[model samples]
Target: MTGQVALVTGGARGIGRAISERLVKRGMKVGVGYSSDPTSAENLQSEYGSDRITIHQGNIGARGDCERVFDEVINAHGRVDVLVNNAGITADKMLTKMEVDDWDRVVQVNLSGTFYMAHLAYLHMAERGSGRIVNISSVIGEQGNAGQVNYAATKSGLFGMTMSMAQEGSRKGVTVNCVAPGYIETDMVAAVPEKAIEKIVSGIPMKRLGRPDEVARVVEFLADPESEYITGQVYSVNGGLHM
Candidate 1:
């Protein structure tokens, strides 16, 4: 793990932050990609050290950004063994009255962002013949949400891609999987209207939001060597919300 590396998108905060930190602690070099958040990036680098953690500021939705982030990881750590496609944005609205920009933005970041990062990871990982990719999807993707039509569509599409890539990657000694998390206790969830949270929790048997570290542990499991036999699967962290 000391020589291996993990590239995590949207790593400045929330689930991404925990994944980045966990990887770093595991003695793996981390390349964190963030969009429009220099302060968060700087803070992460400062905590993890610029030598061990390289922070790349760019939009995950762009191909160039994906290329640049992986390039830096290669230059800094020599090889990329893991990729966590966790950068995503949400534009919650009913399809009837949703803004066009909102729809485009959600699709761009949630769906295209995952594609760009995975494409880059595929290039490097396929070449190495020993790599892991864990995509961060959403429980809403599996069990559709009323107000998040665009976001749900994008995430659901990711699961299909995950299965397809897992088949392709397995032949090359690489594994591809997706992790669909439930309502996690992140700043984004904290911002959810309390009444809305109540409504959301009412559906979950757990009756509580999940923690960032809980999701991080699942990412760690996927990244670990023990999970080598596990691929083409969707691991849900939604506390029985979608089961």
Candidate 2:
């Protein structure tokens, strides 16, 4: 993967950060895309050296921002060989309590944002006849969560989108795959109350929460050129919680 370029949306923190670091360790130049803050991303670039890591800031929910970010990445790195659609937002609310705005916002950032970035990357990769696109989903998407209807919907949507995109990209040597991670130690998961987290962990067969690097490992595998024959599949990292 040396000299290859990768664009990782939401690459500034949590699971995204682990993925970005892993790719860089594997000798790939990474474009780290963050929605609002650039501190983490910039810090990563500093640690990895600016030549190996480039920071890009934009709201993935907007098509215009997606276009500009994509162009910026390409302009900085010359080409993109892998795209990780890891950017997403969640507006948790019970179905009845959920406001229209809450649903719309989550849908826009999680589903629509992924589509915008993937669509752009797909075109570039298909034209080049080689590429990998990995979508970061969640275990909640597989097993619907109580207060996360909107989030679950968008994450589950990626499954169908992955299959269809895989078929379309197969002939062109591009692959699309989804990674559904269980409760990992991310800032998002950390926000849950301690008691809630304990309850969640007790249900996992492994009797523990997953680590971000654990999820990133699967993503790293999927992004490898050796994974060309393994598209349109979902690799669960949920520690037997959902499977």
Candidate 3:
């Protein structure tokens, strides 16, 4: 993916940030899109400098905001070669206990946000007749979580979207795929109770939580030119946790 122009949504931290840095290190001009967190974006800018990195602030669920970020990067980099839909939110609750707001909020950001970014990126990539898109899904999306019904739903929806998009983009020389991360060591996972975390690790054959870099590495692979022929596939980086 070297020399490719890539955009990473929710790049302020976690897997998104790792993906941004990895793509940048590979010689790509990266667009770091975040809903907020100027400090993190500023840090990325410092590392990459303004000439190579463009920091965009916007809500991924908003089409206008998505367009703004796309335009910002296109105007600066001249084109978009890759798109990573990594923006998502979690509103954990059992189905019986989930509030309407919780369900709506998580769905809006996680599922709809991916659609918005892909929708906008599709327009650009379709025009160019080439691009790569990776959506960050969750293993929970495959195996439902006890208290994350809504979150799981959205993520699972992303898998469906990924396949459909891959079919559409294939005719245009674009590729779409998804990465399902299992228990990545991000701030979100850090919130789980110690014992619960231990239980999670024990279930993994590797006996450890996955790292953000683990997820990012998979994303980078899919973004590669050789990967152009492989689309609509779901690659799991769960350390045997969800197999």
Candidate 4:
């Protein structure tokens, strides 16, 4: 993996950061894609050195930004061997309280953005006859959350998209998979009300939120060249919350 190029969207922090660091540790040249705030991306590049990592500033939600990021990665690294669709946002509100803009924003960034990036990367991967794509989903996608209707829809949409793309990619020696993480200890979860968080933790069998690295490890495994046979599967990293 030393010379391979892996593009990880929203790799500036949280789970995305873990994934990028893991890939870099395995010696892959990484493209750290960020929608805003290059601080974390810059840090990763510095830590790994510019030769091993490059920061691509762009919004995955926008088609033009997606194209530019993909093009820049190819120009910088020659080829993209792995694509991790880890960028997402939440505008959580109960359906009754949710505004149209909130729904559109989440869907555009989470669902549409995934499609755009996957399509852009798939073109290169299909031609190369080898590549890996991992879509980071959420457990709420499978088991709906009351205030997360829009977020859940986008995440579940990723499941169908992953399977269909995997079928198309199979013949080309490329694999596409999804990872649904539950109650992860990230900044997103940190904003939950204390009472809500406590209730959530009590419901989980693991009695704790999962670490980003735990989820990242699964992504790393799926992104590996040897995991070509494992495609269109959703790996749940929720500490057995749903199982």
Give the top-scoring candidate (lDDT).
Answer: 2
The clash numbers for all candidates, in the given order, read: 0, 0, 0, 0
TM-score, per-candidate, Cα-based: 0.96, 0.99, 0.97, 0.98
Cα misplacement distance, residue 183 of candidate 3 (Å): 0.3
| Predicted candidate 3 versus true structure: per-residue lDDT over 1-243, tens digit per residue | 667899999987989999998888988989999987899999989988988789999988787888888899899888999999999988888889889999999998999889988998988899988889999999999998899989999999999999999999999999999999999888899999999999999999999998899899999999987887899999999999777
- Candidate 4: which stretches are off by over 4 Å? none
Poorest lDDT segment (10 consecutive residues) of candidate 3: 59-68
- Higher-scoring candidate on TM-score, 1 or 3: 3
Ranking by lDDT: 2, 4, 3, 1
Point to the candidate with the largest TM-score. 2
* Ranking of all candidate structures by their TM-score, best first: 2, 4, 3, 1
Runs in model 3 lying further than 4 Å from the true structure:
none
Model 2, C-alpha of 25: deviation from truth (Å): 0.3
Compose the digit string of candidate 4's lDDT tens values, residues 33-144. 9987778888888888999889999987899999999999999989999999999999999999999999999999999999999998899999989999999999999998
Residue range 89-134, candidate 2, lDDT tens digits = 8889899999999999999999999999999999999999999999
| Superposed model 1: Cα runs more than 4 Å off | none
Q: What value does the lDDT take at residue 184 in candidate 4? A: 94
Write down the lDDT that model 2 would get. 0.95
Global lDDT of each candidate = 0.89, 0.95, 0.91, 0.94
